[model samples]
Target chain A: MAEESAARKDDDIRILAFLCNWCSYAGADLAGVSRLQYPAKVLDVRVMCTGTISPYFVIKAFQEGMDGVLIAGCHIGDCHYLKGNYMTAKRFQVLRETLKFLGLEEGRLRLEWVSAAEGEKYAEVIRSFTEEIEKLGPSPLRKKKAEVGA
Target chain B: MSDLKSLIKEKLNDGADAFLCLKEEEGTLLPALITDADSPDLELAAVGEARYPLGKILIDLLREYPDKRFAVLVRGCDERALIELSKLEQVDLDRLVMVGVACTEEEARACGCPRPYPSEVALGEKVEAAPGRETIAEVESLSDAERLRWWKEEFSRCIKCYGCRNICPMCFCKDCALENPHLVEPGVIPPEFPSFHVIRALDMAGRCIDCGLCEEACPADIPLRSLYRRMQEIMEEKLGYRAGESAEEKSPLSFLGSEQDIKKLERE
Candidate 1:
């Protein structure tokens, strides 16, 4: 059992994507219907708006051993709830700077704009972000199997 | 000292309902509320080295007695906290009068305070601002892994006493985020590393007044002042906002400003 977990740890890079319901979620859906190929390791959570994504969720993702987190939503003026993404942009800066200051690699977390029509763009963001996270390797915050028992 | 007593007396007689200041009691200084001008406690009012969250106390007092007016003694840090708290709608500045007291050189040096005197000093000489970035610079100098390890080691000693939150003057939230079981798990000793401290750091980014009270209250000696001080620096660098700097300006995070504000920040 331990050996199986060890192999999984080496081969799997866990990625959690937070997609806003209005835009990014639709974008991901479009990517699926369009049969666009992306990393299978990526998992997603759908929220009503990007503004609802708290900094705590991002921190919790990393704490729970997520190797990478991507927050994709509508572009600045294109937000369904107008000005919702503005808060996301502002909050992203503070959260990114904070994580960077805490010695977390900058590439592990990312923010992007994916409109409902931008299926290709959503796939591309996932592709590139996965590559970046893979390069940075698993998060240092991830606890080993031995330590998990202790 | 005599001038401060007379000033308190004058304020009490001239419309102030009561005066709040520290009083010497058996060699220990305690916060005392002087309501009457002839109260014997008025004579014991002394600007001692001991510090407390007087701003937090005032918030409760002012809320309890809506119509009453107060004149409270303030150091530079205390004044800044009150100003920030007033902006957050926790304290009504119009109803209170400030009696500023500057810290001595020794006190300033011990605290590593950048601003040791309030805008108006009614007592003590205004000493030079102390350079308080040694810990920050030291941590910044280390590698990312080393820094993370250092913080983990420091935070592991936490007993989750919440003294830092309790003693903080700026903390007035009725529903505290720290107490939320979703954020901080219950029955965990020392709380989870980075989560407990990082949560606080994020919250304090644009609101901390750098009073060093959290560090003073911390039993673990976690260098919390430096952590929060770094948060303040990030606020200044990213958002061009510092808590307690100006009465007219508010923190950018406090409001949902126009799109131009975000553009301006991005362009920078």
Candidate 2:
């Protein structure tokens, strides 16, 4: 039991964040250049457009033990690819609701809009999201039934 | 009744391959492929006795003999199944002729079906039957805890026969997550209850045409249709998409939607 608790303490939360390359990714890079510090728990994947992010990817992340997922894109009409963010908005709406119906907490997934100029907003979003998830603790799905002998 | 017999005879008289319909043999009605148009056995087109997984059987035969064009008897459920199968590229819709038969009021009531008749009818009158969604209503009326408990109880009886998956016209996949050992452990009887069933429900989001075949095929008598019907409602409400409505409308989950699409689900 002591060994299990020690291992649990060492276990860091795994967050999967999908950032649109044109805006949110640039904002993330700017935060680094500005010497702004944030938690390293997040692993970022930059995509050409947030529209390309499938709900299947999000579901796969959860199934694989991702404690939280963040989707950051350009504000509505401000999409670099014109109407690309439209699809992202529609997909996540259904995805979030569907996840709730499946008995998952809606807070586990978060979506935000950050512009290239808003490095501070990007940092703030990440900080708040990470804190929110930390309070929620590790995803219940992460613990295996066999590990707890359930 | 005789009019249906003559309709089948006239349709078959053109010398197409075979006419597939239910035949009453020794008080049991089952699907039979009749080739001889002149045979008196064609008189047994029982309306409500049995419903074979005609779409699946048709797909199998069509695959075996690629060059043949066959005529099939379709009720509302069968038409939906055929439409779904066509989308999956399992059945060639162009090469087949659909002989639509409208279901009786009692039949429609028993199945709790809304559209108890196909879109285009070659036989039977288009009568208005009250859509019965009792299964969904029953589940929807429960509290969250009760709903969860109800589903847990219902799903606990799953034998993993794959009957629900096999009979589903929309479930035409080369690989399935339900069969994956990593996602669903092989030896588990109820197959991890909510996970297995929920995964399937999620997959059926925009694809299931509400054929009710999955529920019919379950040996355990799980109310699989209710779960899928709820999903169908959700898909329609969220995306304004309904399966089997048109071949051109792609499933929202399968495509990259617009920013307008995203706004519909976001908080104001």
Candidate 3:
């Protein structure tokens, strides 16, 4: 039983990452051109700004059984739209605090600053985040076959 | 006091079909609909210790008879409820005549109500009630761990009777998050800790009118009002919006207003 459970844990982790169109998405595109090797576990959604991400989206991601959520945005004061990152910063601060208050493991969600010029930084951030989430195991929110009455 | 009584009598005599207010029945105060203009039961309009949710009762009565027009005595909280109900399309505000009553100093103090009276005054003396900031102060003083523990303890006693939701004048939704088994597991006493209460607080962001009826109806004596009141403060601070303050202003979450609101989210 232990060996079987260990084998199950080896499967790829499902991660949902929100990339800002001006910074994170561009950095990810650059990483692909640079051929920087990283795990392909991430599913990315590109939004006009990281500030566009609602806390509801994060909650919904978990509810949908994503193992982790990554929110990558422009560096503070370096936003393409001038101060967009400021709103993202404040919202994530409150959302992270609120999620922690609800007894959810705060490590499952991460916020990082990735500039359009920093393709290597984006790749490194993704690699580290994926490793951390893989070590943390699958999200408790995932529905088990028996739990679903299947 | 008799002057106020005569004023109510005069209003009733002036073709007011019925007045909605509280009447002491068997030593317990309940909302009563008095139809006869000359009925001596107008004596029941006297301000007393017991409080009834006039808005809730009006919804039931208005639903039962759609064509009838009724006049109701409105306090600050009652007026707020009426405003929200009008927004929810539960009540026809134009059809109802409002006879506003100001709260007494003692009553104001008990409620810590900022606007203890309605828009137009028909009775009682207007006195400014100092808004009590103590509840917020107490919660803010606690560390994150302490705050979490405090809320968990308070929420642990929730009977899941949904008296709070049922009694809320603003809660008119046919589907409720608290009732949803996916978000909140059903048949669980105290309701899986924070999910039930947190969902309620989130939902109350732009709707709660600070009526205090939820806390009043709670069988476990939970401080549900303080939680919702804090959420109201957060909405006003973050979005500059207050529920029931104006019919023209839409809720912050209901619609994405302008580029500023969307931009503000990005800046954070």
Best by DockQ: 1
Clashing pairs in 2: A86-B258, A86-B259, A87-B257, A87-B258, A87-B259, A89-B262, A90-B261, A90-B262
Candidate 2, which segments miss by more than 4 Å at Cα?
A: A1-6, A10-14, A18-30, A40-57, A63-67, A73-88, A113-119, A134-150, B1-3, B26-28, B38-48, B63-67, B122-127, B131-150, B254-268
Evaluate residue B234 in candidate 1 and report its C-alpha lDDT on the 0 to 100 scale: 89
DockQ, computed on Cα atoms, for candidate 2: 0.31
lDDT on C-alpha atoms for all candidate structures: 0.88, 0.78, 0.77
Question: Which of candidates 1 and 3 reaches a greater lDDT?
Answer: 1
Q: Which CAPRI tier for candidate 1?
A: medium
lDDT of 3 by residue, A23-108 (tens): 99999999999999888889999999997886667766775668899999888767888867666665565456455544456788
Candidate 3's C-alpha runs over 4 A off are A1-150, B1-16, B38-43
The TM-score of candidate 1 is: 0.95
Classify candidate 3 by CAPRI docking class: incorrect
TM per prediction: 0.95, 0.80, 0.72
Clashes of 1: 0
Pairs with backbone N, CA or C atoms under 3 Å apart (clashes), candidate 3? A51-B266, A84-B266, A86-B267, A86-B268, A87-B267, A87-B268, A88-B268, A89-B268, A90-B268
lDDT (10s digit) by residue, model 3, range B106-136? 9988877879999988888888888777766
